[model samples]
Target: MQYKTVELVIEGKTATLFLNRAESMNAMNIKMIDEITKALKEVAASSVNLLFITGKGRVFSSGGDLKTMLSSTDESMFHPVMDQIKNMIVTLYTMKAVTVSFINGAAAGLGLSLALACDYVKLEKSAKVAMNFINIGLVPDGGGHFFLKKRLGEHKAKQIIWEGKSIPANDALQLGIVDEIYEGDIEEQLTFMKTKMEARPIQAMIASKMIYSTQELQHLVETLNLETMNQLEMRNTEDHREGVAAFLEKRIPHFSGK
Candidate 1:
């Protein structure tokens, strides 16, 4: 199928799903979310054993399209996009491949959440990441809470979410959010990791992934549902309005504890 927001390329036992909307810094809109879910399903049905997810341009994803959300006149348009985000994450997490998110640049908000869902993550040494929903007075959705707790546990996860800080590659590595950070020649890095995984008992690796993911599946579903519900409530708040306004106006947001 022809995909506008994402590109799926399969070669031998390897496949790549690239976030293709460089115009918006690969910001995930509803169309992009829809296409990502479809593209992931295509990969799941394929012969690929090693899967890579990255962005077309510099940024992995600037996160969710706040502009799109801001322009939304009806709340009806909002719910489906959140639903799509949930579906996309679930599909990626449980897919039958050893997945890696090669973040070549900035990954924030929903973008960071996507990376966190993957089995392994490789971030560019110069890249930065943040779970920055708080900047907009919003909660982290797209399974952010679940993934973070799996990695950082609840206390540290809560710290990152509340702080809304942009962490550098080394800092993220120390925080254990990403597996490795490579400097220059991402192609070389990709080739190396692809070869390394393929050399392993690939099916066994996939089996273990499926086993763990299946065990935690119910909790992930609950998190997604809760995120969707809370995020909807956040959108109606005065603080969220101020945050978006402050972001667009290039100023500090005065978030009332509303």
Candidate 2:
């Protein structure tokens, strides 16, 4: 399967998915979300033991596509986008492989949510991350609300979501969002982590991920089932189909919310 917004490369036990849209800061448009979900499904079907996600250029992701968001008028148009976002997070959280996010630069909104969904996150020293949904008039649509509340606690999570302030890589480390910080060469750090990860037995890694996800998330099954059903319902909308088609064709999607 070929993808436009994302590049997938599988080597031995490691599969790397790069957000290929540097021009847009790898923003979460409908197409990117579809490609990512497709990629995860592919990885799940393969012999890949570890899944690593990163972005091109300077920014990991800038969150939702502002152009799409601004163009949307009908409130119903928002449901499908939110459904996809939730599905992506839930799918990644329950993946049977060890997932790692390599945050090279800025990650905001749904971008931050995706990174946090991974089992491990590595950040460049200069990287910035924020839950920037409040900057606009929208609430956290993705699993940002769930992941942040779980990791940062309810009070701190509310503060971050409400403030929409960017936290640097070092600060993110202290906040437990980023597991490791790379100062010199990011590729070197990734290579080291890759080697370390590849050394583990694949079954053990998968089992560990399952255990942690089950234990950490009390409503894991219910959340994923609800998200899947909601996503299917959203797909029935004209806006959702248009958004997906426009994304695949590499053009700006015009969503009418019909």
The candidate that achieves the highest TM-score relative to the unseen native structure: 1
Model 2: per-residue Cα lDDT at residue 83: 63
Candidate 1: which stretches are off by over 4 Å?
A: none
Can you write out model 2's per-residue Cα lDDT over 119-210, one digit (the tens) per residue? 88888898899987554434555577677777788898888887778999888889877788877665676688888876778688789779
- Candidate 2, clashing residue pairs? none
Q: Candidate 2 at residue 160, lDDT?
A: 85
Report the Cα lDDT for candidate 2. Answer: 0.77
Pairs in steric clash, model 1: none
Error of 1 at 181 (Å): 1.0
Instruction: List per-prediction Cα lDDT, in the order shown.
Output: 0.91, 0.77
Q: Which stretches of candidate 2 lie over 4 Å from their true place?
A: 215-258
What is the TM-score of candidate 1?
0.98
In order of appearance, the predictions have TM-scores of 0.98, 0.82
